[model samples]
Target: MPSLRMFGRDWKVAVDDLAVYAGVAGLWHVVWVIVEIVFLARATAESDQPCIDSEIHLFTWYMSVDIVCFLLYALLLFYTLRGSILDVGARKPAIYILYGISAIYTFLLVINIAASVLKNQFVAPCQDAHRERLALAIFICHWIFWGVWALAALLAFDPFATTSVEQRYAARLWLLKCCSAGASEARPGAAEHIGEICDRAYSTQDEKMESSTPMSQIGALMTLVFTGVDMTTTDYATALILVRNAQRMDREDALAAGVGKPEVAPIPLDMLEDAAHYLPHALSIYGWASNVLNKQDIAAWGCGASCVAPCTGKDVHVGDNMLFSSKNMTIQGVKVMTKSNPETDLLYMSWDNEIQGLLPYYICIDRPRREVIISVRGSLSAADWMTDLLVLPVEVDANFLGCDPSSMVAPEDVKIETTASRRRLISAHKGMLGCAKTIAADLRRHKVLDAVLKSDQHAREALKHDIYKQDCSDHQLVVVGHSLGAGVAALLALHLRSVYPGTRCWAYAPPGGLMSPELSAAMRDYCTSVVCGRDLVPRLSLSNMEILARQMIECSARCKQPKVRVILHPGKKWKRDDLFKPEAEMSADARKTLEAYMRNSGSSHCAGGKVIEARDFLTPGKLLYYEANDSDIADALVFTPQFVDNKEFAKNGMLISTFAVDMHMPWMYQMAVDKALDDAHRGLPSTRVEVAKLEGTCYAPEAAAQTTQQAETDIEAAGGRPS
Candidate 1:
């Protein structure tokens, strides 16, 4: 017998303290079962129907029993079996088994409840003996379940039970000592090293102490950062390419006016063929074997590796319909996995599109086993070429061989190759200077200030009057455009501070365009440009849109984001009586112009359609339409059209107008323009544009100034300056 005093109360157990706790826990279990039986009977009586006539009575009984059982099981498992209840490591097995049994039993109980309800749904009630017998069986099963559950719970905390507190405490102390000893053994190794390995190890340990950081986790983070930057850079490049080549009003001006140099030169077919000859031959592997990206054919080098074990054409199942070009050489293997697990075979072999011929030899390396598999996929010459060129004195590791293998090997050993000589030169030159040139070219193309001065003399005069004198320009300079105009606005605003020295510009709806890193930074510094995320016009290449449509389909297949997006805006309001034509029903000439604009911008053909909808062109939806206030598309439009009966898009809506509309809902662009004009008339002089010229015969300084002043006065009188 053992005696214990807990919280000033004295008690004695027949065996030990562990058994006392177990007995107390078991006693609660019996009470719970008895209470549950009483509830089930009470529930049946409350329903006012006999158990045989009412299946609902049975359902309530099952649910009530299970819910109580679930709570009790959680309490017993956590409070008694899970932690250092009686002992530490001593009851590990019992605790785990108890949890497993509890989980399965709970699932079984839920299933039983479901089955009973489903069966009772359509079945007719009967006053038969079978009905009463079934109801009685259900009740008995519920009681038996509780009994078994209690038995398991009691068994889980056993061995030194029925009063064994002394042994339980001793077991806990022993386990703690073992853990402390193990921890002490690990400290010395951590303090011994101080090199790169030690630094890495220390960092790893520190991270673990704070929170664990796995290598795979680190790899994913690094991958994401690099990929994001790379994608952004590539996008920038693509935009520049399209903007430079795009055949549009602004692009044409940029090119013809020589404001910006063309980014790429058209290469002759023969030259392209010649350049392709020097391309590198190497296999490209993207991730694991998801899907093959390219399927072009080329003549194979005889001694090349094949996915198949035996190198025979008879065994190869490559499609016969696949055509091989004189410039391209391809040797494909049927996808297969050597391991029992089916996912090992990912993207295995790949080549760049530039070069076409396959090399003479092939070699395969097994990563896990560290073995090499070599076979001939091409002619004997190819194999001979490889044997002569690819011989190495050292054995290669299979891991190194399979992981991003390249063609640093001998000529014969090389199977796939591509050359970036031209592209490399372009990248080296374009990397730093590209962005700057893009903006500069756009500024020259639009001659925005000059055009503004000519078209709206009063606007220019207003800018020059009070603002020019005080240099505290209150008016916001918002530059808005579609296609070329957008690019012009972006570039102008980007270089405004430097070019004009003090000017600030705001640009809206500029497409993605190339800018040098320096220029991009400068743009960020100089101006604030709002980009509508899905605007396709900015992406359109200035080249041939119709032809590029085909090219984009192929590019989209490769899943590369286009450098620029091409957005198309249908023509604004026609003459008063002109028949309205939707964009889908536009004339061929209009289509061609739109196509050309997109092609030059380097627009890619997306599967569904354009990225942004025409309705949500500028600003956000909430501000654009009053009905949008509810944030639900199901809501009806608030304002009906005043002009011609038309859809939202068919109205004379400009990107600037759309943007303004969003910012100030219920007020249209016309109202805004009227207000701006009124403000200008009240605050600033309505006439200020002046044209000054050289004074003298292009010689003496004093005479030149006097002549320039005279010319300025004459220009003012001629209405070149605001009246």
Candidate 2:
């Protein structure tokens, strides 16, 4: 509570302000009283007696006494309840006087208005016409004064004097506005915040300033009063505050008033822990993580804007720079610390791409937790996907898959490893960029796609060097990525596991065939994929081949009309072939078409990890979570094998929606991750979900052309010639 002593010097100022207010009101009322006295003397002289009557009793002697009585009562109440009125907790006597004045005067004003309009004279309308007019005017004016006094008295009453600054200022004005509102008001739970109101509303100047009244409250007050929301905004506001606060305090007086109730509910220990840990994490998702997607580095709430993604572009990406000293990056306002250190610095990793200039990804190391994170960005250009498209037929070379770096040797030529998963090609560009050699002039300058087909030791060595320099002394490395970046993260995480024992990766909305199930399962403990509810990207490489085939057929039809269509012939449905191994299921023509589609669209990739699916939001603004269990993602709730249920989902028009496709976007994936953290924090059960799993066998092509001749033509056509 704001104390008078806190503003010892300002007490005199407050007294002077109060005195000035009193002087003005007193002068106005005294002049009106003198007018009434002069009128009475005139009537007495005219009648030759000390008696006079008006058109109506209400506008005659009764109205004069009514005005005088309220003024006297107001003065008496101020003197008698001076300490109580200015103190907190509300004085019943002071409250009754104010409420009484407002009530009695309101009732009288209604009757007085009727009397004046009816022109009822003191004796009769004809007998005292002039006197009756003056009497009625005075009566109406007196009631108006009563109303004003009532309102002012209510706000200056006991309940407002001891509240916190916001509640104090809000006390008279809160009812006119809301919690998020300024002076023009808008809260459902306001009734409970009354006690808090009084302790804040320091009545004295020194206390008012010390109480730290927020500008929001001031705005709210101005909006209500100046905007004319109510004639007595302050009085109505104070009444609400006092009444609500009184209701809230009924708890303290419950038993004393013969009510069987306790003063407070006991705190739940588990809930306290949940609030302490989870609340910040949940809040931070919006406060820090979500802003990374906004174009600006800082929002109105003051969190750093790490997202530099151009709001208008398809390639927009957002990332944060945590190190305060980094140039051209959002400076960290608060020192992000590890458990072991009071102050800490962060690590940043950026690589240059031929198409997008320099793209920096975020890395945070929590030493006390022995964890490091590598966040990756998605493909942003035709050239970038071209890298993913120009797949090199190679397998996990056992010699290089594990630490034996000495045994690792760059491929003599981009060739198939007979023992490796050759039929399912890995993204040639991603593998090479990881090594930092895909930008070789041989490819861009000479227009030679073959030279860039292989990922050699340049990546391994650079990764090793980068890791050595970037290591924040944390042993556990966690990798996270979305869309095209998901495949890269999986590959990087599994590969690094050869050296870093605790490497784990999370891929969000990954396509199919990014990594083999054998590899995914091998790194099962180290990899997890999160697929959002029906996010078509993860399912696209599986069953959406049907959609691709249909689209192609449609495009073929459109060719006659000279309209463009993004049509690619559907390849063999991999999930169908994987399950049934039916030669009839995939005709030679279909096989060829599918291969062409995968080569061009680069859709046949899977996140090599556990896939968890999250529905964007079940209830607006409330996050939901799901658990994943599958070789391919399976929503435990809505999932059905694509081969078994794809036709039905398609028939029902529920197969693919824009929302589902958008779920593949980075922001949606981030929500899934953030929500998971929130659920885990509050100890809520994760929403169990899965999409139909993709499981089957496929005919292994014996070293399908090392590099399709068409791959070179496609890359060349898309502006990827040698620089």
Candidate 3:
């Protein structure tokens, strides 16, 4: 109850203060509002006096509304604060100001009310001089207090002071523009940031050495007024120091004006060695790993004209001396480190920073007619296994007919003894350059009949046919391969073209076959190659195959009709052997033809005329290898076997060779239509009444004999020893 009484007393005091504040503020505002409102309303009336009358009434009504609003506002404040006595710290200052204004206005209102009453009373009495004088004094004090309160409110929301130096400068510029035109034409609140606007303008002028302008003078004056206050603030002080330092630097440059032309040095090959000094960081290892094909020592790997050009000449295949400098040398940015078991020493290469998942790493650069030879005869570490059991091939029965099928399978426990071996035989052994030798030999031995016979045998056959038909007058040849395949293909194309100048192979994805860049370059124009993306299996050299190939095609003198493309086949479907499937089963007639073809082909699998691998498609006694090409044109040939079911197998493991055998049902049915088509196309012309005329056709043996005889004759004509 005592607490209630104390609250009640405070409430009364607040009420008294609010009443006084309202009365003083309302006095002039009421009159002003009434006059304005009366004039505005009366402007539409019949008489001109209505304007004056309307203005006066409107002023009175507006001021009275304000007084009522204030009284209500005071009550609202009391309600808002009653729940929290000491927690309104942020609101306390505003509350106090409001209380003071309210109290003064309420007092003025009381006096005004008293004057009305006294005026009515004293007018009749005419002798109340003391009361009349006291009324005048109260009126004068009311206006004075009103003026002071207005000024205080303006100060509380001081618009000149921005919280930070950056903002202050921004605001100051905004103000200066408004002040220049006296603010009537200025935007709203433009006057608020006058100080900020002036500061920026002056600062800008100072930066440009136009500090002597009139605007700068005004800016200096404004700064003087606010300097002391802002200097005390840490942020503004730091900003000022920074600006001053910038000014000093600008001045120092002005003092040392030198002869004007910018300096640049002449670049030559000699400077390349200086650039290579810092090759350690740029390369995967310390010493330069020369590309065996080209014999050029690449300073670094990957592209970046800016990073590499300073030390090494802009060309990627430069001497390591140029890349050794710290300026140009950098790690090959192309390498992507995969997040795997860190304890393990395996890092997979990705096109970018990280390999996506469990996909195999395959790097392919497709180029033709020019070559990028890498010589990675550096410190290569050899990794060997503990036992041969892990490395040996495992065999399982083709059929599940064994009595104890699981027991028949051998466990991986058998071991073979082996010794570690290393030999540095690279000094004289021809590397990928041997590929050229192989190609040359093949060309020398191959006849036109052989070319036609072997042509279009596989996808590579299609590529060879295209090469033969190509307009090689401008650009002769391109050789392409992936992994070790690329190296062989490149070498073959280059060597073949070097002697004959009639072939090209667009080689891609080459292994680092043992050949120097110089040797490869010497013979590569006859064959070009490209490497599309990063495949670390082929050691990354300073000069990338793709880039070098492209450069040669674009810039080299002897590289005729250059056609090298470094293409990235991310998920290309390479195998296309599903050519034998069809809608209906193999008919009785078609099955017979297929059987004959499989049994009588009798082609050797290698250069030595040895039997083909058991698992080769043509071989009958083994499972399908189901792998891509692995040998030369004839050697790498694939012949599909006749499909048969388990029941068709005889006790001796040979197929029964009967159409009605249940084991032959699936294949017979699956390939019926294709087999029929094959028969129709392959049928003998003598058997047909009318047929397409075949040209340049002959038996393999007859053609080989003719080719051998012709070659001997050519040798004899040239006065060489004939076989």
Candidate 4:
């Protein structure tokens, strides 16, 4: 038995000590149960009831079970202490029985607390209400006492032997079981290195030291004191087992020399310039879409009628920039569409429209750039997240795009022998597809696309700008958005391409599960997607989530030991406060798990059915992955923007980094683009190594010049340019 001396007092804990603690807890429970019973009996007698009904009797039964389980646990611990169960093998059954009783007692206590709270909340106004309040307090006290006892027992008994040599044996047995189960056999050379890998799985500073870190000790203390033992010893045991299993999986790939790197192309200088130019507008529109400021301010800023009241002066300046400062560009009206009222088109003139299902978009004309730009806002509300998750694949058709289904070629031989060569594409994510349809319908209903194409009198009236007076038909149509809006923008561009040829899309951090590979590949001619470092949104797809789930399950299944122990014998120094020191690394496990997941994800497979292949769902268009370069420059870090292959983009899994979510922010993308441009001007190498250059007319400056020249020639041929 282990013993410790604290505050000049000997503290010795054994099975008998645990038994005595259980007995004390059982007596405390009996006292509360008796008080509750007496109070209930008095209330029933006052109500003129013959006896307690089944509903009221439930409390009685629950209290009885709690008392019985605690007493039974105490009895079993005493028997073990007395050596009645001398053999270790035989004693195992008694220990399991004790754990089982504890589990039941913990469960009943939870139920009792919940019932007491409910009773207190719904109790009718009566003289006996105070009695119910008293009972609730008693239940809470019982819970707190049990939590403290459980924590003390955990420290005293060391039931799971986590610090002893038994843990190493347990880790080894787990690895062996996994190997025997064929996990090790799946990868070559894993079996030969099993011993070395198992050693690493359980290796620590000292075998006899407690595995609990100072931070974990603080967390445990907070959980015990504030949350009242929400997680039991069994829960902690299960967590430890899962962690050990993941370590084993990580170690299995430890010996691999290198991971295959995907080939990457440097982002074209012209494209990088375009992305940087439009990023501000893309970010600013989110503020407009949120409808948080004064309507006058929104209208003054060229974004239609604000949906809500004015915010404070401080809120208005938050992320506010000179969105409409460019003299060459004219601000057109914004179109705010929602599913609730599809019939009503909310614009600069409309007011007080419910913001539900709101998808706000605005169109602008840039004379210098010769472009008609439509910008959509990203997710900023609960409704938007709901849209993001609605990723069921829907087949692409004219009806799906808000067009007459009858017009799109009689639904005949949709399949062809040259499947890869077929021009027609299949499906898209339902959420983004719906958003696209909404935007398309609104554009058509208001003749917005016509306005961009012709720039005639109606165009001027529709856009509320005189810039339409200039034959703006020559200007290229560009669609831009960030995050959820990015996905919607991509889909909208695809649908609008046929009506307005040369339509281009700039999508920043679009959803990873937006469209089929065929559509994604086909869109490369027009759409350009920008992904910042470790942005989880672009990698979060249903397939990837399923893969992550499977990995967790596989890791859990590989472990055999589901118990953990705590060491209370402070090895040398008696510094009681040492248990609460801050940890040096908080997210190390998360980082490791993310790394292992990404490494093994390529080999994992999803269930096959009528469902679309996980490989088929990918981010649309030409992908530009923007990442920071590890340079020797002391002043500032250089960011390199590369056009990576679609396969590389598809292989990206959701990041579990501490900064993963932060990386997805619009400012992060903007900053990276800005840095890349700055680096380009400074004559620094944009990319470390480049494999190939992408040939495309989308981002090429010459393409815009040629289109402008062609429009001029056509106008002259038709008998002179428009006045």
Clashes of each: 74, 56, 103, 0
Candidate 3 ranges with C-alpha deviation above 4 Å: 1-436, 449-477, 502-505, 523-527, 540-723
Top-TM-score structure, candidate number: 4
What TM-score would you give candidate 2 relative to the actual structure?
0.33
Q: Which of the numbered candidates is closest to the native, going by highest lDDT?
A: 4
lDDT (Cα, 0-100) at 649 in candidate 3: 13
Between prediction 1 and prediction 4, the one with superior lDDT is: 4
In candidate 2, stretches whose alpha carbon ends up further than 4 angstroms from where it belongs are 1-343, 355-359, 381-383, 395-400, 403-474, 540-547, 550-655, 674-723
Candidate 1 at 674: error in angstroms?
54
Cα lDDT tens digits, model 4, 158-226, are 333122222222223334334221122122222233233323221222331124322222222222111
Per-prediction CA RMSD (Å): 30.7, 28.6, 39.4, 19.1
Clashes in candidate 1: how many? 74
lDDT of 1 by residue, 1-723 (tens): 112222232223111213224435445545645655654555455455444334554445465555554554444434333221112233334334334445656765665666556554423443245544554565556656656655654543333213222222223333433321111111111111212221231232434322312221222222111111111122223322332222222323433555421111111223222112111111111111111223322233211223221222123333333212210133322222122111222111222111012222222233443322211111123222211111111111222122222222334433232421111010111111222243344334433333232233444353332211222122223222222223333433334433344443333323222222223333343333332211233222112122233332222222111111211112222121132223454434334434533342221221111110111122110011111111112122122101110112111122222232242211222222233234334543222111111110011233444434443443333234332
For candidate 4, give the lDDT: 0.50
For each candidate in turn, the TM-score is 0.18, 0.33, 0.16, 0.49
